[model samples]
Target: MPTIHSGPVCRLFVLLARDAPLGVVFRQGPRQLTQLFLWHTNTDTFEPGDRFVGNLSPERGDLSPDGKLLIYVAANYTMGHHNKGLPPRWTALSKPPYLTPLALWPNDEPYYLGGLFAARGSIEINLAPYALEDWREHKPSFPAGAPPEGLVFEYENLPWTPSNQLFTRLMRSGWSQVPTRQQSETVDIAFVKAHPTKPLSLVLGMGSGNSHTYTVHHEAGNAKTKLVGAVWADWDQRGRLVYSLDGKLFTAELDFPGKLQPSEIADFTTTARRRPPTPESASQW
Candidate 1:
């Protein structure tokens, strides 16, 4: 038996129960499984909760802070076919869904690097903004101007702050001058409690320069998680340090700084308010 703690998720297939104090969901394969687990710090053991099942693949999922609406994503498409038969039949070839209406976690897009959704918000007729080439011919059409007013960006870019923000790096080859301030796009900002008692910390991802970098911004006094050619998909908090990681579907604490060093990893699958830490063994002085 192991004791669970209240913290961030470090693995995939995690769901915090809304009714139960500590109901955690973990995936066994395609099917998601939930269990009631308890944390008995005295002996470092976990108790079990009732089981529930669901699906939460990264590409098709919707688990908000309160766990109410389950947003789902699927291809919205019409098929093309070649009908040539004595009886006049048709064959199905392709159905590609346009990806848009990607809801940034907690907010709609057009904001600085926000959480992305798989669903398209809207579709307008006669809006083939980008040039399309015949698949069989493999010939491309010349690029064009802005898309229709309602046309969404074909590809959505998540918030990512490049290193160049603080200082410019001089690259000898394949480099160009930084864009002037007027050319810079104002990015959307989302603030989460990075550390206890710290000023607002922002999920600094979207930048006018590059959309591939993700970094954390805190007041001058807090620890910073800088992007080093990686995307932080998930985050959890522990003693003094924020545990940022990937493939999280459950909660755990990262006992150290950065995502590099993790402390005694414990699962707090249940949603119970903070309880004083119960020592597994007698305190040592």
Candidate 2:
């Protein structure tokens, strides 16, 4: 039998595009290493992107509506390997599935800084008051006072604290806070995010020192309810149920509420570390 090391459990976070049949997945395993994958919801296939020796913040990431650009917050504390002399923590913009940064901004404060797509080609980044640091391939307009045309920056110029920023991203994107009973401790909080069109909604709980965990609860019209062992889940662009469980991703048709016949999409627990080369066409970002 093959040896199974009792190492840390691998975790996955899925980011689906708003208007496209595309998704980006972050597979974190073993330790600080994280691998990125591009998911094609059109055919339920995944393509390997690249890996980073640092840690990526899923709460601080946002995929563009067209699935072309990716804005993520990454941190590398290693001193010798490839710190690049940039800040210890930074927010970066890169092509999906690849860690090769196209435009970078330095951040003094690492946690809770996030970015989102204002439109198809425009983005708003929160860098903790730091300015633009580098632009590798193509340079976008940088303005300190006001954003460029066709761009609506609501959270870029504002300061982001720990809880406010995280909650704002959820509310701003699609999620709404689910009401809970008033308690004295006030530790448990929940949110329900529904698909824009479908009748599916995912209930997620946070707080009580377990906000990073992605345990989900499924309640179908107040009839059938159960704790579906999903690490992270959401609806894909095609209105199909896409969820991650046991270090693997699954996609299933909404044949019936509260019952899912999941089809495996990708497994991250046994995924090998790879550094796929970025194609030349990826540089145009």
Best by lDDT: 2
Backbone clash total for model 1 is 33
Model 1 segments beyond 4 Å from truth?
A: 1-61, 76-196, 199-202, 207-212, 218-223, 227-230, 233-285
Candidate 1: tens digits of C-alpha lDDT, residues 1-285: 123334333232332212222212332222243322332223334443233233222222222322222222222122321131111111110011111122211111111111122234222111111212222332112122222354232222322222321111112111233333412245432223243454433243445544433334445545455433332322322213322233222223332243333343343323422323333221110
Please name the candidate that would achieve the greatest TM-score relative to the true structure. Answer: 2
Candidate 2: the clashing residue pairs are none
Per-model C-alpha lDDT, please?
A: 0.27, 0.66
C-alpha lDDT (0 to 100) for residue 123 of candidate 2: 68
User: Which residue ranges in model 2 land beyond 4 Å of their true spot?
Assistant: 1-9, 129-157, 182-187, 195-198, 212-221, 253-257, 273-275
Q: Estimated TM-score per prediction?
A: 0.28, 0.78
* TM-score result, candidate 2: 0.78
Clashes per candidate (backbone, < 3 Å): 33, 0
